[model samples]
Target: MRYDTFLDEVLVKVKTYLAEDGTLASSRDSKSLAKTSDLKLPLEGSDLSSILVDIDDYLQKCVKTNHPNFMNPLWGGLNIAALAGEIIATLTNTSMYTFELAPLASLIERSILERMCEMVGFSNGGGTLTTGGSNGNMLGMLCARSRGEPLSQRRGIDGTKLAVYVSAESHYSVEMSANVLGIGLDNVIKVGCDDDGRMRPDKLVEEIERSIAEGQRPICVIATSGTTVRGAFDPLVELSEICHKNEIWLHVDAAWGGSCLFSIEHAKLMAGVELADSVCWDAHKLMGVPLICSAFLIKDLSLLRKVCSHGDAAHYLFHDETESDDLGRLSLQCGRRNDALKLFFAWRERGDSGWAKMVDGYMELAGHLESLVVEDPQLELMSSRQWTNVCFRFKAEEEEDASELNTEIRERLMQKGNYMISRSNIGEDVILRPVIANPGVTKESLEGLVAEVIAHGEDARRGIPSA
Candidate 1:
């Protein structure tokens, strides 16, 4: 078809989709419309119009996380500024590899990285925007690994076994980084956590000593600022001390909880974050930036350059570094997208005060959830209110079979499509996890979530599981 026709079609489709946003939260409609079968793919070439039809159908059927009642993952709600940045980014199609290719993106990225490092209290620091938290963690590990064994990059790990450490409750991406870095998973030590799920500094120290005694070289200690399972934060101050004294590279995987830096009360949870040699944060998670905007910031700017520098590669794109902007030297990727544009736009649009208010507002909502759990006689709070994730469970009427019944109730809720809450096994009992990372969720929405849980539990007791 003609370009004008395609443009008109795209605009019409976009407007149509926008109109359906309010009704996107209708679970009744979504459940009936959703397909469980495999999607068909075109074997031969198809027109853009045909593809658009299929795409729109799938999108409309999918859960709209941007909706007010759509609270599934960490991030939700839309930031107009970041959305605008995404459109510009797609149009530019610029790669951050060299100055000539992405001069303005490089500058924006540098400013964003600097501001992020400062938020983490890194005075002399620099970083690069990453694809997401996984990539950010990978970059952090890469930098740490390179710092320990400079020759490892050139010769590769032949026989040397370098160990990285994190709590048992830490994100799976830590081990993934070890695998990608060619360091075996066996070398990644999973230290024990305390009763509240926070990593025990003493256990960490013991693990490091054990690894060293077992003929393993301990190089990096990854402290989780926000663990995936429980949103538990390892004691950064104590862990940093242990890491620094032992000459281990300290890196904070604060991808989920990093936004707490914007909140005065919550930022205290990530105390001693500045002591780390490197930190990984996802702007998409708590900062409410668009997807694919995460950062891997190093305490020292030169360390990142040294780890990922491909010097002496004289190319047209990288030639005019002094005259143009370049961010490739300190990145894991060669052809990086303008992920910083949206994050930069988000920060600029909100300013510092607006961002802080947003963060503090979420914290208040989490606090409200904590109170709800505490007030309810049936629900028991598993973890203390740390950041925003609240882990709890529906208690049995008396103590006949609370644990098992609660676990069954959570399963039934998901199967029935009443509501969705994450489940976690803590100290032999499974608890419902309501992660309040979405800014769109309000008190009323959370109350509705509780009501749904109770209603589902009542159904489970009656032996009528939700369909």
Candidate 2:
């Protein structure tokens, strides 16, 4: 096939995929899919026409994350402007390590980071585009470690004596960060959260005091702005005060709720965020940018540089004249992608006001869904709705096992493949969690989701096996 013909065919497929009002994903199990798909890696290369067939097959089986019912993950929906930027970046492939290689991309990334820092109340602060929120969290922890023991960068210290604190409901990345930083998982003290899932200030103080009494140095307190299951935001103001008093670094994981900063009314959810030492915000989540567009902003840019510092070794890449302009000097990555262009394009297209509107709209939709859940006799709201995550479950009858029934309902939903939501737990009770970060989700779509959930619940209660 000709190159233009291949490109045209791909574009048509893209358009068709966007216009599709179909199921979120294929119902095929892993074994079934693996058995059916072409798995052989032939020594001989195939023609462009064969490649197009493979592409079509792949697209057909892939989950349509851009679908209206795709409320499974923290991020969904496609931003066209950002998509364009992604393609452009791919077309002009370049590493983001040096200004000499990626001058324009470096500037764009810096501008995005600066704007994010300003939003977080970090005056004269800066950060770098990371792989994802996990990487950002790790970076934040690294900075905290560096600050707590400045000389540890050269002479490693006993991580067993260094302690880090986070909410019991915080992301698993914190534990991973501790493990990576040589701070044993046991050193990561899980702070207690209130009924609403926010970390309790008093409990935090107790934990810190206890750690100190035990001869352990509390190095950092990582707070979550939006938790995974409940979408809870920890009280940043109180936590920052505690950190300041204890002379510990505070890092806010606002990966899921950072976009709340765009709205005047919602920004208060993360109040006192400016007082934190560092923050990791994911533009890919609420901002609707493509994957891997997360930023790890720090109040002290020099500290971040120090944390990521490497002795002069790559003479081929670094020059004294352009060292200040090089982004790699401040990043853990070397051959990084230009993830900033997509975010920059999206931000330019939808200015601050536009993002504010999006945030407010999502909240309103979530409120509507909550109302629907409340009005229904068979459904129950598992937790208080803070962000867009609606945690609910089908109320079981006297003899029915609630968790088992809900699990079956979710399985049926997956098999049906019309709506995609997550099945989670709150304490011991199983709950259905459908987040509203996807731009494709509307009030009507949410209404349909509720109806589908109720329908599936009814079926499960009747002991009807999923087709």
Candidate 3:
């Protein structure tokens, strides 16, 4: 078949899957089907009919993340403009290693990075786009380490006991990075958090002082702007003051809710982010861009280049002395995809106000979900609707067993492929975590979810004993 015909067939299937009710399947399942002996590429010059089975099998197992009911992970929904950009990017197959190879992509990434830096209040700031939040965090910590011990790049991290501090509730990637950078997990300190789940600034200050007292070098403090589990924001201003006084590098991981920067009302929650030396952000989360889109931005452009790259080997990437602003040199990876294309397209389509409107819609939906839980005595709102994550528990009705009932209810929902919501234990109470990151979700949809959950809970507890 012609390439155009093949493309048309695939697009048709994709549209059908998107309009359908359930997901096709996971990628792993698709790969398994594709790897079958009959599906292998031995029959190279085949007619359309020859590979039809393999094509169908591969497409059949693809997950339908664009479905409105897919609320399991933080990344949900699809942006049409971004999707079109992805198609263009794939067609071009541009390598972002140098400006010559990807002039448009290089300019786009730098532009977006600059815009993101300005959003964080970094007037003279610059940054690089990463594959995801984890890599972004890695970049921030690497920069912090370089700044803390300039000689570590050559002599390596001497047993000077250099350490990084984060809240107990911070993303696990912070600690994982500590291990990867040879800092050792023991050197990473976990600060305490308050009942609201926000990192306690007082405790952080005390911990840093104590670390210094014990002959440990407190080098960097990672303040999470939006945490993963509870969707909590740390006290940035308070933490900034402490980090500034001691000259410790401050980095903010706003991977999940960093898009709130576009929202004027909620933007204040991330105040003092300008004080951070570096920040890790994920555009894919709230921006509705494609997956694996994140960035690690730093206030000082020289810092990122100095620490991350050696300018001595700049002949290949930077020939023009006047224009040495290519992105590949600052990044860890060499042959990077033009991930910025989709993000740039989305930003262009939905300017500041449009993006803010999308975020506000999610916030409003979350608030509605909160109200729904409040109205029902059987369901208790676990925490306030901070960001778009709504944490609530299916409370026991008089003599009913709550945990077992909620667990069974969650299982039933997932089994039926109706609505995908998650469950977590907060202080021994089983709570449902529904994230309204998708703009397609409405108040009525959330209310219906609550009803389905409660209905399943009631059914599950028919003969179960009370705790």
Candidate 4:
């Protein structure tokens, strides 16, 4: 086939995939799929026609994340404008390291970062687009370390003496950051949370004092804006006050819930966020941009520059004239992709008002799901509804094991491929977490999900195996 003909065929496939209301995914196991897939890699190259067959097989097996039933992850659905930007970025094939190579791309990235900083109330602040929230959190801790021990960048510090604090419900990335920073996991204190899963300020204060008493130097307090399982927001105002009193850096991991800032009604959830020293927000999460589009904003841009500063080893890349404009100077990476274009396209298409509407709609849908779980006699709401994550479980009679029964229901849902929601544990109880981040999710979608859970629960109780 001709190149243009091949391109046309791919476009047709994309259109058909978007319009179809098929199963969320194939029910085959990984071993089964591997056995059936075309895995041979011969010395001879395949023609364009053969490649089309491979593409069709791949598409047929892949999970339909844009489908209305796909509530398994924190992100779903598709943005047409952002998709265009992604394709354009790939077509251009330029590195984001230097302004000389990606002039327009560099400016577009800077503009997006500036607006995000402004929304977070960071005046004259700046940030870089990172791989994801994990890298962003690591950058935040690295900055804190540089601030605490200014010479630590050149001369390493005793990580055993340095300590970091986080909520018990904070993302696991905090612990990963600790490990990467050479701060032992034992020194990374986990502050207690209240009944609502929010970090208790009193517990944070207590932990800070205890660390100080133990000859440990507290460098940073990493507060969470939106927790992973429960979607709880820590008391930022109180946490900021505590950090300020102790002279420690405050980094808010708003990766999951940062889009709440776009909504006046929900922005109050992260009140006093401006007081934080640094923050990381993922547009790919609540904003519905593609994956790996996260920002790490710092109130003091110079601090970030200093933390990321490497000696003038690459004289080939750095020049005095374009030094200020180069994004590599502010990043830990040397060569990065143009992740900004997709986010910029999405943001421009949906202005702040559009984002507010999207956030508000998701919250409304989450509220609807919560009501369904509460009203049902066999269902239990595991946690308080905060953002768009509804954690619930199916309850059975005293004779049946509730946790096992719920697990069976989730396995059955996956086997049938009708819905794809996460199965998580809150405390000792197993809960089904169906987040409403997908724009395709509707009131009817959630109602069907609730009904399916009850039906599966009944089957499991009666000792009926999953179909």
Off by over 4 Å in 1: 1-52, 158-160, 311-317, 320-324, 397-404, 415-418
- What TM-score does structure 1 among the candidates reach? 0.90
lDDT of 3 at 224: 88
Model 1 scores a C-alpha lDDT of: 0.80
Tally clashes: model 3: 0
Residue 259 of model 3, lDDT score? 88
- TM-score to native of every candidate shown: 0.90, 0.98, 0.92, 0.98
How many clashes does each candidate structure show, in the order listed?
0, 0, 0, 0
Off by over 4 Å in 3: 21-55, 310-323, 397-401, 463-467
RMSD of each: 3.1, 1.0, 3.2, 1.0
Best-first order by lDDT: 2, 4, 3, 1
lDDT, residue 124, model 2 = 94
TM-score head-to-head 1 vs 3, winner? 3
Off by over 4 Å in 2: none
Which is the winner by lDDT between candidate 3 and candidate 4? 4
CA lDDT scores, all candidates in order: 0.80, 0.92, 0.82, 0.92
What is candidate 1's lDDT per residue for 235-324, written digit by digit as tens? 989998898899999989999989888877678889999999889999898877878788888888877777776643646445554522
